[model samples]
Target chain A: MNQDWTVIDGLQYSAWSREIFEQMHEGGLTCVHVTIAYHENTRETLTRIGEWNQRFESMPELIRPVYEPSDIALAKAEGRIGIIFGAQNCSPIEDEIRLVEVMRRLGLMIMQLTYNNQSLLACGCYEDEDSGLTRFGKQVIKEMNRVGMVIDMSHSAERSTLEAIDYSERPVIVSHANPSHFHPALRNKSNKVIDAIAANEGILGFSLYPFHLKNGPKCTLDDFCDMVVWTAERMGIDRIGLGSDLCQSQPTTVLEWMRNGRWSKTMDYGEGSSSNSGWPDSLSWFGDNRDFPGIADALSKRGFSDGELSQIMGGNWVSLLNRAATPASPFLQHP
Target chain B: MNQDWTVIDGLQYSAWSREIFEQMHEGGLTCVHVTIAYHENTRETLTRIGEWNQRFESMPELIRPVYEPSDIALAKAEGRIGIIFGAQNCSPIEDEIRLVEVMRRLGLMIMQLTYNNQSLLACGCYEDEDSGLTRFGKQVIKEMNRVGMVIDMSHSAERSTLEAIDYSERPVIVSHANPSHFHPALRNKSNKVIDAIAANEGILGFSLYPFHLKNGPKCTLDDFCDMVVWTAERMGIDRIGLGSDLCQSQPTTVLEWMRNGRWSKTMDYGEGSSSNSGWPDSLSWFGDNRDFPGIADALSKRGFSDGELSQIMGGNWVSLLNRAATPASPFLQHP
Candidate 1:
């Protein structure tokens, strides 16, 4: 593994702690886009941010907040993990387009238009019918573009994702999802979606979450690397990076909260059936943040050059952030 | 009556309708600060704003939104009542300091730190302990001042109200509360609070709500005018205006929602007792927006000069808004 490589994970929703921060350091993770909100509203999202604020205050040596692309370099220089805030759902903004700017100012860098259901903005992958973008959704996309919040369509329906990519002036993102050509999972993106993303110069972060993988918990390092290579060949290496979708140290209850939120009255198994409700076992090679070096080694063995490996690891993500996360308006830059 | 005088109601929470809007026209109202949130969170508050948006669209001829003091002048020129959005509680902003600016940008011109109990920002009158201002409250105040959102302490505790007046760079307001000397209701402000407001160049908008009146619904026009005269002598006429806490066509359920919200499992009658757990009867001389002319007539009968009448009726509120509601920072103006 190249020590100089800027290793960035495009998405993670870990039960964050000092141990995990130390693990990130061990993995030489420069920056990690962390989910601060799943179904949390503005106030609840603020509480989550407050919790992260406390973590940053307590563990300043291990981690710092990444407000802009340059912060990743600063974090790498400081030997600390830079955390970029993201929302898995648009719940944090609720129905207000103005909150896109507010959340951006408060350091929310990425937001998915929908999770796994029909949202105010767009239809999710799990919905029966795909409503590409509501009137509010179009307004929100414009606002998100103006404020430089990355529009993530990982959990959104295919039509919505395509519409978003087409509608957004800035490049969109699938912060954490693999290719459906490899896995055939509902959460994974189709070739068309990936090509659209590539055409729009958007990034597609391959998900390592068992449910989004080809062989679930038993997925081999070679197979995952092969999938990455296939995606790179299809979407171009510059438009790809790692988004492990790691849920390190989180309990089953937290998983339930992620899948169900307050929207469901009864159980919603999500990607799992009743018999497989709990989180799947971690893959042998990439169990946690500490396993990133192993992934780099696997990619190297799979014939990726040092330059290509560097881009796959985090360099691509850094470039994407530089392009997609800078505020469009000068006035928004100050606040 | 001086028809040219800009007649502004400092606050109103009527069950707004086209009928009520027509009543406002009849009252010669230039502008009205309407409460859009009591206990609604950020999302729910946005829904309320959405409802008002629909109203604005439907009744463009009757009313227009007042984003700034100048908007009021435009509304008056257009022969329309300017609806200035306000929140009776800090629930809309929740715990985020940044939302103060966001809400302001969305046309929320005023926010009370507390409704009638302890909030995240300050202590309400109903609370046993009056924590003047929480750490978040101070930050919110600064943000509100910077974004040009008026700080209203109409339902706050004595210490909190005084502290807010002292802490805010811009003039604070008690948008709809009578002086405790005139009416000993817990909802009314104390002489200390009123004097502090006057000292800080803040305005006190006398409430027409029966609970804040001398003899409830039986309170005569003369008695109300005398109380106004007395308050003017003490606090200066420039610092007084009408808030007319009129509940026009709202049901008892709406009143209950206002008093109890979701905070209380058991009923909290607020200003009313258990026996009187509903809106107080409307005052004879000032029942609704259409009755403003009678109150002005009563004030005139009480030997108030035409200049004093104009100031008391609405001129003072317009001046107070000009002083308090202009954004402190230039960057916030565009957003």
Candidate 2:
């Protein structure tokens, strides 16, 4: 098993910017799955996504886009942060099915079926009745498989999550969710759902959303590791991984934008207010505490082995990435 | 034409208490389309709805549930407000399609298709794009038509609006939109779209979200009148009406919940610290302003004929209520 000692982030919402790239370099991150959007967007907004790709391409060799699983080795050889751009919401592709490939070419490697709510493709995690995938949502899952983007079901509801996992030829990833066996309400995945994914050999990246933690925002890095360990016990070691959803920079400036609740759009940047009442003093999400090795050290303290350590740190993601990689078939380009 | 005002408030959302009821009695409001989810409670929400029937049924002269057009005249003779008990969002139906009739039989006469963004039935007015109606939404619309509830598309998006309007064998409603001819954007409908409704013999409502006005927060009552006049000229006076969108006692406390960049279930009372710099405001919302009569006066002053004024003020809605009056036939009841 002479694999690269790559630290792959299965999922994160960090700013896909130079500052974050710099932080990834400093944080010992060899790869990161940066979420884009799986929400609604106008055509003009979708075009700007092309502009987003240009920015990813602009980063120094310290970071390069990873499409095929083979790109990981090449990036590791250079000791660069492999930025695997993904969409938190799928609104960028809008209703067009072909843009899936256009996005793949531009390096969108993974996509959640929905964000905090419903999209044309699928139902979200919080929708009351747990609507399975809509007719279009099922199409999206198949397209996700055909295009080889890892299907991330982190924010999708139980029925939708199960349907997506069942529809996907390759196993999907619950890229960032907390164990529902521990807590209930807005941010936890159901146990039945976890068991189903475990059977499918899917990965579950435990989230750091304060609401997902039993201690809420007061949970320390130690509590975060405990959650990881607890989830692993329930969902088998190989089916679990670390997805430290840390952003390199916490814009004290942008918290109000979140209050607008749209998360991405700059509708009222200066006019909104924020209430960070749930933040734990021990936690730091902005650039200062984005240390990858620091998180690894916490997992090690929780009795994680070099194998489990390497798996969560990056290997599992590499394996999943390999499984989801759609070989560039020149013969099937158009027909 | 001696239909002395039945005073059917097309829609109203405010915390219900003995005080609010007294205000309704004071306002000479014979009936109101009161929102169950936005305000009111389970203890007496339906009890209050049933109370309207018992009070009116007992009097056989005053307040009653206006399930048919003929109920208005009879209610006015008795002197009670017709309570069209309903929900602002179908979220309470959660995801069940059968609940449509159970709630309808329980006095849930009108339902806004989607509140502000996405629901199973259609996209909200606030969504970036309307994914049109989902299969469940189509089923819901058909069931609504069958069950005899008026399909209010006031808060729905452009695409969802058109699709729902077309799918519904019964004419639907733009229950609370100002015309783009007044102030164009997401909240206002285009002449073409309004014309489509008129062609279907459906109704268009004038809302008071200040952001949809010419000067937004600076808009005056006269500006509101201008919108009504503009819609009348385009959609015909007979088809135009007032959705007033009045939140009489609550002071528009739910605006924050709507700014979730979409309609949200989580309630955030008070002016939300939101990122909707671009969202519509309430120059017209008057949240707590009971001087809604002033808007009526403005319409009267603007030379809306006493006949035309009466029609726009509430007659058109009465006609829609009559048309949408859950048909009594089994075909109408279970279409």
Who wins the TM-score comparison? Answer: 1
The residue ranges of model 1 lying beyond 4 angstroms of the native Cα positions read A1-335, B127-131, B263-266, B301-306
CA lDDT, candidate 2, residue B219: 84
lDDT of each: 0.87, 0.65
lDDT of 1 at B321: 85
Each prediction's DockQ against the real complex? 0.06, 0.01
lDDT of each residue in B111-155, candidate 1, tens digit only = 999998999999999889986999999999987887789999989
lDDT of 2 by residue, B194-252 (tens): 88799878888776656556776788776677777777788899888766566544433
Best-fitting candidate, measured by lDDT? 1
Q: What is the interface root-mean-square deviation of candidate 2?
A: 26.1
Lowest-sum lDDT 10-residue window in model 1 chain B: B326-335
